[model samples]
Target chain A: MVALSPDLTGLRTPALRRFLTPGLVALLVLASLWSLSSGAAGLGPGQLLAALTGDGLSARDEVVLYQIRLPRLAMGIAVGAALAVSGALLQGLFRNPLADPGIVGVGAGAGLGAVLAIVLGGLLPAGVLAVTGSHLVPLAAAFGGWVTTLLLYRIATAGGQTRVTTLLLAGIALAALAGAATGVLVYLADDRQLRDLTFWGMGSLAGATWGKLAAALPLIALVLLMMPFLARALNTLALGEAQAAHMGIDVQRMKRRAILSAAAATGAAVAVSGGIGFVGIVVPHLLRQADGPDHRRLLPRAALLGAALLVLADLLSRSIVAPAELPIGIITALLGAPVFLWILLSQPSAARG
Target chain B: MLQIDDLKVTLGGRDILHGISLQVRPGEVVAICGPNGAGKSTLLRAALGEVPAQGRVTLNGQDLRQGKPQALARLRAVLPQDTQAAFPFTVAEIVAMGQDAGDFAPEPGLVRRALAEVGLDHLADASIQTLSGGERQRAHLARALAQVWQPVGPQGARWLFLDEPVASLDLGHQLFVMRLMRRYADAGGGVVAVMHDLNLTAMFADRIAFVIGGRIAACGPPDAVLDPGLLERAYGCRIAMNTAPASGPWFVPQAAQAG
Candidate 1:
């Protein structure tokens, strides 16, 4: 039967969305537990629990838990949440379902920044090197993304109106330019720098450490903190920029903040994890299909679902080749494409042709 | 009162509106009628501050140019000519957006009541994409109504500025909406609409403004402004004038229980 008043049916879906918070959190917990256990140095659930409480732990197990597995899990959750939430924000801001930070030039720009720092570190002064210490690459990557987004915004936005076509075209051109610049830097790099670049370029969760996680976490946290306030504004934005403005949303300010948040999230994630793809696109798209597209529901939920999906993917990445690892990017593209295609085909008027 | 004084707009090296001046008071419906390319929508956009224009435009004694959007929103709402939802939001969710302006709590039940007023209560749960063009227009109208739901709030008379509000609607829905406009004016709100149908304007509007080449060629009540000779000259087409309806109210939406 057709649901007769939105009073009855409209509120129901959002209520169900809110009710899903705990369930998604639980899924994240399960994924995290499974990830903490399944690896090169596999531990059972009991031992996993024992490793946590520091009760009857072996020195080697302790080393693995604190240094390897824990940091990896934390980084997976952080980067996953960051990528996913950035995807949700870009989709909302552009009012296009297909929009993603990776699809745009933001990630590519960050990648160039990481390469620049890696290849040019010798030219920096000793004092500056001392100041940057271990954070040179991630900081450069975040700054690069921020600059690219601003440049893209300048190129594609005219008089407070974003030209989606221009944005898409400019993104293609910008990504190509960044890729070329990265190539030149790769050509410039010495042997040791080439090794760092190669390992980083492959996009693995294998080398996650507390120091790398700490460098990226603060920026991602800022993006996550700014998201909730954007929820209501982004929901109204789906009605068009002018309509959103009519609803008293400060369209200019909201647009700036949204771009900033997405750039920071994408930049920080790319800096630490290299180029994990499809999490941003697939997570929000799947959630919107399962529930609805209200950004209030989509944003935080995307974070949790993204984290869980990545953790599970990472688990599969290492275990499928046990004692060796496949790049996480390959796994996501492999997994996400089929699920995304299934969703598209299942919709009754999928093409609406 | 909403005032536009000597307002002018230029776009892409062409003038759209030139020193157009008008005033709308509470408890009245004003219609702007003109042929295509006569700058009717441009005038409306200038008033809403959607396009930057020179000269003075004010609502309730506050200058629209300097007035904060949040403050302006509480006093007036606009229904754009066309809108497409970027996502699959429900009709009720679309209307609920109108319930709040910037920093105010939504008026409880306004979304339901607005949907009912628009004869869309049954389809409130439906996806906005599933709606026909006419239905979509009405859904947006319902949202516009919910924006300034109370005819007169603490800030004096609330206002709705609609652009071709009935352009996509069917005959029955058009009359229903015209009557709704009449009733809204009767309850002390003000409305300014860019109108296409002259008969509906004559039937419902308290004042009429005829735009031609970026200026008001004629302005007054329907009896004075809708002259056949003036309309014929302005439109460059032969015109006919009559009042009687050959007609039908067709559908009353009895469940809605309103005019």
Candidate 2:
């Protein structure tokens, strides 16, 4: 049987896109508010608004608003947007929708780095290794992530061509190595460090603070801004490297830039949020269904939807068990696994290859 | 005019196109016809500066190798075989990609006209991923059309390099695309197309270049180059030729052959 034609008339206009994006942004703001107000020490919308806008609120409410919920919300939005944009860029670069930051080993490497910091903090002097020093863990994580990404990139590229299969295989190899190192570090951890390592490995927004958000925000913003400029180049690249070259794009240069940018964004995200799973994998696919596969639309929309999904997931993680919070990664996996299964089951015949 | 002089392309220390030379004048449609691995596509790629080649290609007396990418892009465009839209771009957007929007901005009306020229105006808003094989080929042809649509300069010619532009197309679309190429040449453009179908080549091509192995075996008008002897030498088969009522000569390969 012949496939039915897609109805594209409604989405062909840039004006419609302009209108819809702002509307989605407004919905995201409302969702953020609902998340901030509905926590254990529940603040009413009015009290939350008063705290947010500097009107009037109790000291306890002010502390909850400023200290707990605000930073977590910011981290959720920043990490969510970063992962989604990086995933979208990697997918385009590989021309495979299944490519994600986690699959490429950046997350594993960052997690290993953070775990090592926790384990080693127990042995070192207080001045040399301070766990609460704001920048220590993130700095180490970023360094580890960058090293892994560079190594994988070098192994995959030979004579200026990146083989997708080789890249994936190398990523798997590196991830396994990183995972083994992480296991060894966990085995060597002391009691206090063990608890910290376990909690961080499971992933959380519980320790979110203004300092962490400040470190993550600029990297996410840089990635988002760089992504839109690459829309045309990415569209050409999807046709394959030879075709992209014929259309005047410097394919090797574009691939290098895209990989570095995606690595930086993913590294910063994992450093701050402790490896939130599946937002990168799921958000782009979901956005593709609504915005079509045009990266110009898909990239920005994926960022927004990812931000919204993570915010909602954070809300569920905090509220599902009341006073004791569940890990945010657990919530994302629970929500993402079913959708992933659906996509696997519902694969279009033409997309099989 | 497009001139290719002693072009030799090597890939991985193996020569793919060996010392090929050809010239196409303004208002001419030249067809390169050969067997599957005769390096027809390589010749076109070499001329378009897509492949690393030893010799020179000049368009209107300007060296294509020395020209900047933007300058060369404005001078020519290509439509390759097996056109696939890996992303879900709209038909109009795919066509607009051919032209540099900075120098030759995408006018909606012009995109519509280019699509209409390929009988694809109705599919302008259609998703490129959703189109059939023939529809997608036509959309790519529209893209090439848009690329070469600038006003004639003092040189008065633009070139189009097509590699098997109609191999996957149906007969109707094949003829449609050939007719469009002929129209472009009639309007003082130069088109160098690599074709597998000899009958279509005989009908539309002003000149034919028959390639064998990695070199041009014969080059002339269709009647001179597409003789039975050259077909046997290039394709390694004896063939019978008959004239089509509406088109031109058609060849039927013999049942078996030993090279």
- Listed in order, the DockQ scores are 0.46, 0.39
**Candidate 1, A155-263: lDDT as tens digits:** 8766544555677788788899999999999999999999999978878777799999988888899998998889988998888777787788888889889988888
**Candidate that would win on lDDT:** 1
Name model 1 segments beyond 4 Å from true: A1-18, A121-133, A154-167, A338-353, B102-106, B245-259
Q: Specify the poorest-scoring 10-residue window by lDDT in model 1 chain A.
A: A1-10
Q: What docking tier does model 1 reach?
A: acceptable
For each candidate in turn, the TM-score is: 0.91, 0.87
lDDT of each: 0.82, 0.78
Q: Give the true-contact fraction for every prediction, in order.
A: 0.64, 0.34
Per residue, candidate 1 scores C-alpha lDDT tens digits across B1-259 of: 9899999999998999989999999999999999999999999988888888999999999876557777877888889887788677889888888886622354567789999998999888888867888899999999888888888889889888999999999899999999998888899999999999887888889999899999999999888887767776677665656555543111111232221
Model 1 lDDT, residue B171, Cα: 95
- The regions of model 2 sitting more than 4 angstroms off are A1-19, A113-171, A185-196, A345-353, B49-53, B58-68, B99-102, B151-156, B242-250, B254-259
Among these predictions, the greatest TM-score belongs to: 1
Per residue, candidate 2 scores C-alpha lDDT tens digits across A271-344 of: 78888877887988776655567787788887888888889889888888989889998988887776655554
How much is the lDDT of residue B131 in candidate 1?
Answer: 86
